[model samples]
Target: MSTPNHKAYWKTNLRYLAILLSIWFIVSYLFGIVFVEELNTIRVGGFKLGFWFAQQGSIYVFVILIFVYIRLMNKLDKKHNLDK
Candidate 1:
């Protein structure tokens, strides 16, 4: 790709990364800790929502995010004609 296109591609890539990471941070840190007590009032499968997030839910989200990132990057690569 040309210089401008390359720059745009990387910019989009970084933007996607930043947004996903921010979500992970919010789910893992904010929900798991800062709002734990409030979330504890809710239940999923007999587990406290907050406790689940702290112990397991965040991990699930992170793994899902990894797949999402991979998918997004693949699309981006195709868009930029960088995919093999």
Candidate 2:
């Protein structure tokens, strides 16, 4: 009954992309790379948070992050009536 707005759709997608990218960059580069040593003082399973972030933590975070993104996008899709 209504027309689709492709540009608006892409713009919305781009906004989400930018937000996700920024978060990824900050977590991977800034916290993991720059603050590794300072963060190593705190321990997680015999690993400092920074060390964890550097070695095993980031991978785990990435896995969790994928689920988070899926969950978020599912919610967003429902909110926008875009679910298929």
Q: Which candidate's TM-score is highest?
A: 1
lDDT of 2 by residue, 1-84 (tens): 444655555566777778777777777877799988889788877767886777766677677777877877787677677898
Give the TM-score (vs. native) of candidate 2.
0.71
- The 10 consecutive residues of candidate 2 with the worst lDDT sum are 1-10
lDDT of 1 by residue, 1-84 (tens): 479989999899999999999999999999999999999999999999999999998999999999999999999999989999
TM-score per candidate: 0.96, 0.71
Note the clash tally of each candidate.
0, 0
lDDT of residue 10 for candidate 2: 58
Task: Mark the regions of model 2 whose C-alpha exceeds 4 Å error after superposition.
Answer: 1-4, 79-81
RMSD of 2: 3.1
